[model samples]
Target: MDVSWEESVADSINTIYLLFSAYLVFVMQLGFAMLCAGSVRAKNAMNIMLTNVVDAVVGSISYYVFGFAFAFGEGSNSNPFIGTYFFALKDIPNSTYDYSFFLYQWAFAIAVAGITSGSIAERTQFSAYLIFSFFLTGFVYPIVAHWVWSSSGWLSPSSSDMLFGSGAIDFAGSGVVHLVGGIAGLWGALIEGPRAGRFDAFGKPVPMRGHNATLVVLGTFLLWFGWFGFNPGSFDKILVPYTTTSDQGNWTAIGRTAVTTTLAGSTAGLVTLFGRRLLVGHWDALDVCNGLLGGFVAITSGCSVVEPWAAIICGFVSAWVLIGLNITALKLKFDDPLEATQLHGGCGAWGLIFTGLFAKEEFVIQAYDSGESGVSRPYGLFMGGGWALVGAQVIEVLAIVGWVSATMGPLFYALHKLKILRISVDEEMAGLDISSHGGYAYTSHAEESQPRFYADYARLQDQS
Candidate 1:
């Protein structure tokens, strides 16, 4: 098909922003790599890194081939559950750079797969993980994403319009991306069971320390930085001194999302640090990182609607929720290596609930197009909606958690019965780095004695 010069220029500009967004999302893969590697025992460091890299590779291929079609197939179907099209990319128009759009979304599919690595690290079988990654990115993640983000999705008004009164209000994927990824992690962990010695015979929890705090910290920072792009780039409509609005509405709301996301993140980090200091008798680095992550998850759903003060409130509350969830997991004997369940599932749920409670009138009006007679969400406490919005929030939380957990529980039970979810006892003892892949992150030789030397040096300095 022939194209006009102006159309070609517009397409070129859109392609640039799309590529930039893809680059930002791609950086998240490194974040997962570092975070997962640093969360596990040093003996299994190489194995964790290998899993992350390969999951991205396999996930991208699977998502590209079938997942994209299943998700945004541009169909008129009414089903709110699954997508319609089957492997139908060739028919997509070349002018729209539909392939580029697929590439960008495919990157995000792999990002979701990466979220699970930290949860099931060390004990998960390489082969089982491969199968899980393939299915998850190709079918599971994309279907949910399409439901929330695609215009033709049943959740959107353009389609069924019956199921979603508020159109599944996931502004930045509190449920579609984070919760789906976290719930999948929860299931995989339950089937695989706790790592050996992670809990005592009496079911007492044991702390499994990371090999490198440096790596973990680095990964956390990268994720925090990449999120700037993740939340704002979701608009997918970047333009000059002012980003263009989608045909749906003015996209400048993306700026509001970016600002709120930053505020919540810092505020949550500080609260977690101090909260842990009071509880654990010291400033806990791990809790601080997770707390910041909780804030990121919490603000995601309402990034464009909630006011600055509301973002602060959401951040503070989310940190507390994150710490509580971690404690709850331990008490319940759920051994999540990096606490994926708490940071993503637990806090992600809170973000969605808070959005319903705190979403402001002006922002909502700006972003959404209700019919002349349509009713709007009452302004939250700040806007005077009071108890009504909070009540709606409560319903959203119960529905999301119950739906995800119920679907996941039986799937996990079946995988356990098949014995495909976990590595054997012998393999566990040998360490996944050696047994599963015949690789080691570190060799035992001269470096093995370095810790002793460092300890001795510290003692000598103390005496001096």
Candidate 2:
């Protein structure tokens, strides 16, 4: 097809914007690392950090090799369950736009892989974590991506079996990335079991607070910052090339998505704070942090489709979900230190549902019509009438949860039966930094040797 110079310029500009957006998404890896690092006990700090680093490394290599193919290859011609083309990405064009799109999606893939680390923190063997990261990124994530995001996906409105409405709408990845990651995380936590001392002989859960509140707060802020890129960038909203009359609506979705994301996160944080104080008689920083994230996850699916007011409602409800799930995780005794099972998995499911209940018909028209595919998506019942879209969402979320758990559960079970998943009792007590990596993260004033170091420091200060 012949193209005008203006269209060529637009594509080039969009490519650049996408590349930059991917870089912003890439920084989220650091956020996940720090957040998970701070959420674990002092002994497992380095271990969690290592798991994140390896996730990027392994995730990148594996996803590059075949993951993208399974997710995006063959595009419209792709199979329903998975893509059959682009093995080793051989079919992707050499153009700047294609590569930028590839890189952006790759960043999302890594974040999904990293989410599970927090749930299985502390007791997870580094080898097991590395292996799971490889399979999850190279195989599991890509398959799910194909199921929902790819044009041929059955859950897509464009699919032949869009059983409900345009299949299902996950503006970003509430179901594709977060929910899938959460279910996988929960499965690993359940199979790996709780950390030593996490439960007593009476099976009562014990409190195990993280060693660094500062890091947790910092991590939360960083995640929030990167989320700007995570949500708005999905639509490739660049101001320069997007000035044309036709592109204005795309720009609006981008702007509104960003606005919704910010409002959702802020409202979720405040709601979580109030809930914490009301329930625990004190405001808890970590709960607030998780609440903020839960809100983001919840609004992600409908960021472009839902109004800001709806975003606030989702955020508020997300905070409630986060708090409830955290308590439930403890009650279930899964030993999930990060409450990610609820934050991402539970809230991600809610994010999709939020889209079904509140997505505006006009906004959905703007987003779906302006989308690169030029597809007319199914609308929510509240906006267009009928329960098709919302019901599809419920089915989609359950299917994703069931698929991830069923796949990851057996893999973890095999690893468990082989005794390669969890660490030994001695290693659990000694901390993963020293046990797995053969060293302490801090040696000068060793955290594990705090009593001895503090006593000596007091004596020296007295002499001074």
Candidate 3:
């Protein structure tokens, strides 16, 4: 083949990799759907599943129209708060693989938007939630993306400020995606208030167990499998700058990331199982699943940069955080049906901070210098690096928390004022499947107790 032919082949390989990675990430929606469906009561199964579907549909549209622009756009007018180009995925060359890149990002966008659905699953009105999903993808997620992932982002170590440690080294968006989704979900749930009977008059929590352990475990396994794409496929490019990297640069990153990601999830699940047994005297399958998922979230930021041992530490601590935060949310009167706060928000923060403590100097250097990111974090504490990266991580966490809470609180409250933030108490008691969507997930006599689920979703729509 000619040199030109060789170049085309290489380009095609990268393009194919990117597209396949997007597909893997896209499948995470199914994981979210099954997980949510199983974690909720039987009456809300269909609702949760539909909400997951809607997140991909509405969230993708909004991200294409607005989110991609705010996230990746840049020009003379671009600023740290947002990107000023790529609106509607416009003005980008198709041959540049922009479409494939956009697709991958769109999938990520929907995943983040979907996080809120679980926390507010049983109680949120479908209309209000669709609206929230739309804005969340179009605005909330992209804003954080601009700040965290954009090369020109002020928080990017690649930026010229030299102000903070390595401009908050999140190789894969623990903050922009996971933390953002988690906090937004938390705020939305808090505003909507706890589920009926979730907290008694004396402020004690009541048990509202999920109906299907099988589905929950299945979903967790699916998420774990898809996470191979989530972490390893996070690389924006399969090639690196020849001036800064050796021939095996991309290959090494991929291998290390996959290993670390796997170790963290596996370790966390084991730790959580033991912890739950010690604390509650039983080996809870559900807690183990959540711990595994939390471990994945916790290791995402540092997956490509941390050593395998650090992954174990991140996962081990993350398991405890998952349990502790899940309980704390209850004490705070937040009725999160799936513990979104702990899995995404709390674990994501730990991932970011732990990265600061455990990320290796060479790996961080290789990552920053490898691609167009121009990002370079200082050495982590364990590597004899100072406190700069940790400090930046803390600041970034607090800032994101404030940003999401401030924005989401008002938006949900407005929906509440408009009387759409939640389903009617009557409808909630009846179950959203029957009252809102009008169908039961199952066909057995269990449908008898599910009158609302048995209702005609098409004709009995509750738009008002």
Candidate 4:
């Protein structure tokens, strides 16, 4: 075959690979919907489900209009903080990126909103959700993506003047996607406070378990399936040969990434299973599912560069990180219905730190495209690299926290002040489904009669 033909074939393969991955990532929306629906009380199921559906719908429009531009638009004069070109997706499908790339990224942007939705699930007003979801996907999340994932980003590995000679290595956005969403959720939940009756008058905890375990398991498995694409699919091209004569290429690294992701999630699930058993004297499937997700969140930063063994370590530590955070949240009376802040925020921070400690030299070189640049980038500290990578990773954590706090924190607080964040107490007691939406998710003859019975009772009391 001619050289031009070979190049064409390579481009076609890469495009197909990316489109397939985008589909897989989009399937995660179903996973998020099912998981959120299962985690909240039955009374609020419909409300939470609707928010999850709207996350995708609203996020798509906002991200397409400006979020993608703020993230990856690189003109001749590119800035480190944010992109200035490609607004409204004009001039896209250019030399640098294609529509498939945009589709894949849109899937990710919506996932951030999905994560935040879980934090304030049961008590939040539908209107408040609409406002925050639009702002986050359009602005807050994109800025962070620009800082970490964009080529011109100051924290990006592809940056010209890298931080500490080694920019933050968030290979798959543990910090960018998970941490941003988690922190945003944290502020929203904090401002809204816990669901009604979530705590006793004495400030002690109350058990507000989800209404469905089957849906939780179904969602967890679906997320696990989608993660195959989430981690390995981040490699936009799979057809590039590593060298002219070598058989190895990005395909090998992609497989390794998939393996590491699986191992980390599996290890975290097992640890959470036994650990929770020891702590609470019962094997809880829900804890295992969250632990598994926490593992995936932590390993997302270093999944491409870490060894399989290191991924296992990442999972184990992440499980405990989640458990400890949950305990602390309870103590502080911070009630997140789905533990989004703990699982994503806390574990995602740990994932970035884990990458700084476990990333291997050869894998880092192969994964990061630093070999051609002749720049010997820093690897993990424990791998004998130095403090440079560690320092850079720490900077990324602090910057994400600060940025999300400054943007999303105040957005939620303003919503609270406007008296539109949470529902009224009577509405909360009656449940969002009945009070806000039309009715309950599940209904029966008995349930149908109860509403009329309550109406009659109230009427008689008023007359008397």
Candidate 1 backbone collisions, by pair: 379-385
Q: Kindly report which residue stretches of model 1 are placed more than 4 angstroms away from their true locations once superposed.
A: 1-8, 75-79, 157-164, 239-251, 369-411, 444-464
Per-residue CA lDDT of model 1 for 1-464, tens digit only, reads: 89899777867877777777778878878988898888888868888998888888898779877788777875544245566555647466663667768777877788777877678888987877787788778877777777667776655423445232455456777777788778888888877788989899899998888888888899999888778767776666443222133343434577778889988988999999999999889877877888998899889878877888889998999999988988888898998898897788888888878887788866765544421224464445456656654554455455555555665556556666788778776567556765655446876722674565345445444644
Instruction: Please give the TM-score that candidate 2 achieves against the real structure.
Output: 0.92
Give per-model CA RMSD.
7.0, 5.4, 3.1, 2.9
lDDT of each: 0.74, 0.83, 0.84, 0.90
TM-score of each: 0.86, 0.92, 0.93, 0.95
**lDDT-superior candidate, 1 or 4:** 4
Error of 2 at 314 (Å): 0.3
Question: Ten consecutive residues with minimal summed lDDT in candidate 4?
Answer: 455-464
Using lDDT as the measure, which candidate wins? Answer: 4
Residue lDDT tens for model 4, 1-464? 44598788888899999989989999999999999999988878999999999999999999998888889887654578867655746765554348889999999999999999999988998999999999999989998899988888999887788899999999988999999999999999999999889999999999999999999999999999998889999998888766532677889899999999999999999999999999999999999999999999999999999999999999999999999999999999999999999999999999999999999878887777723435477999999999999999999999999999999989999999999999877677767786677567888622875875366445444644
Candidate 1's displacement at residue 190, Å, is 1.9
Give the local distance difference test score of model 4.
0.90
2 or 4, greater by TM-score: 4
Quote model 4's TM-score: 0.95
Q: What clash pairs does model 3 have?
A: 434-452, 434-453
TM-score of 1: 0.86
What does candidate 3's lDDT look like per residue over 346-422, in tens digits? 99999999988998877877677663345545768887889988887887898899889888889988998998888
**Which candidate, 1 or 2, has the higher lDDT?**
2
